[model samples]
Target: MTVRSEPVLVWDGAIRLVHWLMVLLVPLLWWTAEEGHMDWHRRLGLAMFGLVLFRLLWGLFGSWTARFAPMVRRIGALPSHLARLRQRDSTPSFGHSPLAVLSVFALLLALATQVTTGLFSVDVDGLESGPLAIMVSFETGRQFAEVHEFNFNLLAVLILLHVAAIAIYRFVLRQKLVKPMVTGRRPRADFAGADLPDNRARPAAMIATAIFSLACVWALGNFG
Candidate 1:
């Protein structure tokens, strides 16, 4: 847990893969929607739906650092976290710092909203519908579509803020946060005296997470 003189692993491999895959998927979803490719958009939306489920499941049963308990503790420590931030503390946290955890949670909430609403969305022409849209009345489905659009705007804004925060960390704080998320390691000095967590997801955890994620997506597609 204590910092090492060598680059220390922070994000697990599954976490990194999920993070980057969503990064790739988001823009493709946007492009598909903009080009009136409703079919592709729905397919990609389902893919993202699967990824989000995977992440939530992983947070529960994956790695020590990826659990909700630690994130909740970090959120509860906001006062100390803010004090350390004001002092320009460079001591790396177990995974994401408290402030970053807030943003992470915010982004997740926003993305979750987007996907949840999209599930019941219906187009004005009634020609396109979410996988679950048929389960709802036409008026209700249209309302969900409206919320889905609004949620996308919220998601876009959150994403901009996220990128800006990364820039601030890099230029203002002199911290290269993105690199570690990509490489899963941080330089020794960046985490000096810090108790860095380096838990990787076990084979059992990964298998369970993947199977459960797929099952949830399948149930929604078939039943709803």
Candidate 2:
């Protein structure tokens, strides 16, 4: 039996911050939007939109493990990993499993689309239309507005499923899936064998994230 001794900081602090930030912001955004707390809800929506744009850029050019190419794997791998779970056997995990990677990408894409569309959406009472609502024709903006609302409901379902899956992994499978996300380190017992990616230096990830975040803000200010 081989024992893995060394622990690696697989997720950089920025990555962890963005991860939990979304977790906190999602529910707040949902409830406030539904309850007609438009002022705070709109503020939170804009914040989340900016954060998602930042994350998209980070996923493209940030740390080794953070890149979508490495994090999102082939779909077939998901079923195989789940089968291993059924047998009570250990599965190889470095960053995210294939299904989780897909879920993250899907959620990000959906959020980006929904947020951008909502910016131009108008309510039935003619009270509010997004700041950029005038950019597009009224008819097209209305369609996008409807899509935005539908996407929000879809995102909620996905989030609930994600939370349930994490719970199963924690209690049923006896794995600390959430712990690694919180601490950025996995306990030795969490896996049978762990083969992780080569961690890039922290300075590099931070530099890339900062540059990308600034560029998004600049563009939004100038053209938004």
Highest-scoring model, lDDT: 1
Kindly list the per-residue Cα lDDT of model 2 for residues 68-121, writing each as its tens digit: 877755556878877888886545366777767887888888888878888888
Q: Each model's TM-score, in the order given?
A: 0.91, 0.85
lDDT of 1 by residue, 1-224 (tens): 98556766677888888899989999999999999999899888988999998888888887876777788878888899888778987556768778888888998888888899999999999999999987899999999999999989989999999999889878877878788788887666665566556576577888888888888888877764
- What lDDT score goes with residue 13 in model 1? 83
* Residue 204 Cα positional deviation in candidate 2, in Å, after optimal superposition: 4.0
Backbone collision tally, model 2: 0
RMSD of 2: 2.9
Pairs that clash in candidate 1: none
Candidate 2 lowest-lDDT run of ten: 187-196
State, as a TM-score between 0 and 1, how close model 1 is to the true structure. 0.91
lDDT at 85 for candidate 2?
84
